[model samples]
Target: MKKISIIFILFLCISISFEAKSQSFVGLRGGINIPSVNYTNFVRGPIVTGFRNEFFIAPSFGVSYRNMQSEKIGVQIDLNYSTKGWGQLTLLETNTFITRINYLELPFYLHWQLIGKKKLKFFVDAGVYVAWALSAEQEIANDVDLVENQIIYSVEKDNRGDFGIYAGAGVSYDFSIFILQLDGNFKSGFANILPVNPFIKENPPISTNQVPSVQLSVLFPISKD
Candidate 1:
């Protein structure tokens, strides 16, 4: 599955290059991610109590490609490396446990132009994404003092593959030769990242990932619109 995704991305890149002289835009994007985990059917063990969920700041960057189907409608695809995870704060916010996971994500969007036909435009997009986890780590820290601090690397039980939905709205400006766009988006995973343990199948835990992000991109026209 991972191989197939990689191949598809490559194919898109090639197609974009070949279609450079058309009504298409390709660009680079960078953003900040606020990632968290939602837990359902959680077993409230002793350690789970008194821990509050928190968000962590992470980085996301990628290549974005768009093909304008019409003046008001288009299609977009992005290949990005996104850092995502959630943090748990102990009672009184004295200590914190932050789990970090990094993934390669591909998202396809239906793009819409809500306003403006000239320099500045308002737009919206909705899509779905597939991601493969590349790595995972955990950081433990003491908020009150500097006594306990450690980092652990583990992926033994993590379910790496994730699929999710994404939606965003933003504004863009045309520079004659290139376009600048700013987008704010939210993504929510449908797949459970916490795999069910066979031994504990009767009472398994469930967790899903979500991220909210703001991105800026500079798109150069392959061919003039």
Candidate 2:
């Protein structure tokens, strides 16, 4: 599956390069992420809460190309990395655990302009995302120290890949030389690729989860004509 996704991304890049003969832009963006985990069982509350609270502002950067200079629609491909996680205390006394999940995401979305030739234009985007887990770690702190005593409840580092749907809306101002944009996006996952270890089930179903994000970016034109 990983190989297939990588190939798909490469194919998209090639296709975009061929179509965007005179359109290309590179930019840098920084933003905040509010991510929450969802579980399959509706009968129970989320296995985790306040997962989004643990995260601070995360930074991202990407490049894009518009096929036709005057066209109001185009395709965009982005590569972004995000840091997100949560922590919790076990039922046992004197034991606490923290889980950190980091990911590298690739999103390909169709971009549409909602307003015509003004300095400020409204836009909407819809796309698919493939995320790879960089790492998952847990830290344990306990007052009593024993040779075989482990404060960490479960260290399942199996969550590796996720597929999600993404949608966003934003406004952009195009200067003769550069463009600036501010956007907010949401992503939800439908599959659980988390690896199962001593702490979690091998196939513990992970349901749709929401990841809300906001970004500010500045783009430089490679060709304005």
In order of listing, the candidates' clash counts read 0, 4
Model 1, span 26-45: residue lDDT tens = 99999999998775433443
Q: Could you tell me which residue pairs clash in candidate 2? A: 158-194, 158-195, 159-194, 159-195
The candidate that achieves the highest lDDT relative to the unseen native structure = 1
Give stretches of model 1 more than 4 Å off. 1-22, 44-51, 143-153, 198-204
Query: Per-residue lDDT for 1-225 in model 2, tens only?
Result: 446545655755665555433465776666877755553321123333221113333344454544433457666767777754444343443454444567787778767787857688899987678787776655554543421222121224445777777789999998958789999998777555544344443333443346788988787776543
Score candidate 2 by TM-score against the native: 0.66
Residue 166 C-alpha lDDT in model 1: 79
- Quantify all predictions' global Cα lDDT against the true fold: 0.76, 0.60
**Model 2 Cα RMSD, 1 decimal:** 6.6
C-alpha RMSD between model 1 and the true structure: 5.8
